[model samples]
Target: MGYRRLDKHILKAIFHRWIESQSISRIHREEGFDRKTIRSYIELFEAKGLRPGLQMPDEDLDCVLQELLPKNTRGRNKRELLAPYREELLRLVNPDASSGDPESPAERPAEVVRPKTAYLILVEKYRLEVSYETFKLYAREIGLTAQSKRAPTRLESPPGQETQIDYGTVGTLVDHHNGKARRVYAFAAKLSCSRLPFIQFTYTQNKESWMESNIAMVEFYGGVTECLLIDNLKSGVLKPDLWDPQINRGYAEFAEHYRTFIDTARVGKATDKAKIERLIPQARELFRRLKAIHPTWSLDELNRQALLWCRQEYGRAVHGTTGIAPMSLFEEQEQSLLKSLPPVRFEVPRYKPVKVHPDRFFTFEHKRYAMPENCRGQSFIARESGGILRVFDASYRLIRSYPVTEQRVCWLPGDFPKSREALMQGAYPRYLLSRARTLGPAAERLIDGI
Candidate 1:
């Protein structure tokens, strides 16, 4: 069906509404005209120096609009002109030589060339009369695509051979402690063979959370894989490279404890770790479902729900590619193949070497917290774990402990001592002296001596 044409009166109404600062869509609803037609009319009026505030008679307005208004011009038909060269064009675009190995750049046939060159050939040899633009458009109309040079090969690992880890944002959640919503990230790991997966959620993707999640994942699976294929995330890989990837210190310690090697995926290649990489969308969907059930949940509560949902729903379900339930497949074959977990758990805290100031305070998380008096002018290591920030001496013995907070400066009770001279130098010294003198003449004499 064709679009309804707007008359001069309707066109003027729409343009006037637009001139009065009404949106094109709003005018379209009120004036019963398409937005395209509305834009054309407004553009026509502007082209003739006729603004909204300017006064013009109906006759003058019609004259200016009629002169500037666009006419319905139909383009010439080129179907018959190019019909004879359709098969030849297809052949030139996708030659047999190129078809043998489409991905091999070295094997690209000379006849398989650009559209412009093909158009020139048709003009010179076949005496074609169509313009290059029309030819290019028609070329796209047929099924034709540029050949690719790189042919990617699929890689698979044996059972208990490799596991891939990746972090994905699981939307926002409320931190029950602070009563504020913040973005949460999910650390996911999937076995390459059976596709069994494990996930943990955290507020931060820092070194502490990353290492904690890795430990949690291994514990959940009850075994460790020989190799870990992780993405080039800053928490895990300090510097990403095709060879000799620099792993973070904490992550390296965790790997050593688990007796596994860390192999990072190639740069710009998500498919290198496709097992866990493919689980992000699934994880997102699971998070959405959990959110609908419990719209507002703490980070821990959300993760608990995620764990139950994964086991009952995704784990027991039949796999799309392997045609077997992931849990069943994992239990029957991959379970025994995986290496045994360590006897003791790995605890890696957020560590920083800081020099204690003269005031017996150390800077942590961009904030200052009080330390022991003996730690003055000495270098100590600060560690944060389990919501408790602690300072250790050179021998790693815990010297001080304080509750973690986001405050700029925190002072413990009785940290700073008070003295008579220090108090007398205050702004309220006169009032303090008057109150002291009320006790006795001895107080007055002492205050006067000071």
Candidate 2:
């Protein structure tokens, strides 16, 4: 009969039957094993001082079996091939080992090397002959390598405490007005506690679009969270820092208007605002499905469909992580906790610093607007919104307001100095005549004739 390996459970059953005073032949018949196999196991147990009537504890039996069974050497030959370079492999994986003992510095290189890279280095430099898989297995067995990943800790937030926001690209779509294809992006917002999502699609991801999307999201939810978590997009965050991030001026005003706080995620760290980060992919997939069904949809129509999907499908469907529908959670548990919206919606404005020229004029949107003579050659803040440009002094005091028109030059009567005002108001001819009269009668007559 061929040799067969018996597990601890099988051996324990055989011993139990033998201890019950069953004959070897009967035990073999009942256990479906050859009589010789049963007799051999009994003989081995007897040799180990385990009498037929004596009861052996499970732990003691396991220990006895461990000592009696032959050691598994299936991969012994492969491990022996790597034995010579074990120290080298360990050194490559553990760069800090060299610093532990200062008495004798490690001769091997001290730079940290990944296991796969180390395996390649060993094959190339040291001429070690072993497959990458074999090297990894042996390295793990010898404790030269270990998994660096650990289970991630889930972040929990109170309802209405925070909202996470992000922007993701949804493929290009044709503009209904222009009939030209434009790259489109989806703006996603999610409440941290409810996993409630609000999605908006736009042709641009500029500062204007960013603020507009945020406003629309808040209006859709009919409330605002206490804090807004967002990625370090240039439109929202001017500079990204771990401790002190610089928020965009317009976005700051938007937050202030809604009585909310703006918090930015760390640069390149998606897990900082994982709630919104997780929504982007799902939003993209939803948009793709919408586009597939309505291939000729315009940007506006696409946005309309996306909002409907968020309300009827995405929001109503149970979330994989929360196991609850987002809209249901929001309506049942989160909506009342949020802060109330302002009486009037915020007017999105673009903030820029503009310098008044020596001629008492400043340029905005390629059009020149005249400043007060006293305010000439000074830097002022220009806030443009609702077809109007409002200029503010350094102290944030109102300077002048002008209609953002298509006219090349925008000026008021008081914008110029007293001296220039005369020239601007058609008084230059009279002034010239007066000067000519002072000069000579002939000059005055010549000026009059001209």
Best-fitting candidate, measured by TM-score?
A: 2
lDDT (tens digit, per residue) of candidate 1 on 19-57 = 688888899788777677778777777877878778788
Give lDDT tens digits, candidate 2, residues 1-450: 566677777778888888888899888777777887788888998998887689778888888877766566466676678888776666666745433343456554434455665676667565667787788778878776767654334577999999999999867776778888778799999899998889988889999999999999999999999999999999999998989998998999999999999998878787888778777866766665566456688777888888887888778999877899989999999999999999988999988899998988888878888987788789999999888999998777998898887778778876665556668666888877877899899999999988
Give each model a TM-score: 0.49, 0.62
**Candidate 1 — which residues are off by over 4 angstroms?**
1-154, 353-450
* Candidate 1: worst-modelled 10 consecutive residues by lDDT: 418-427
User: Candidate 2: deviation at residue 180, Å?
Assistant: 2.8
Error (Å) of candidate 2 at residue 347 is 0.8
Q: How many clashing residue pairs appear in each of the predictions shown? A: 0, 0
* Colliding pairs, model 2: none
Candidate 1: RMSD to truth: 25.9
Scored by lDDT, the top model is 2
lDDT of 1: 0.76
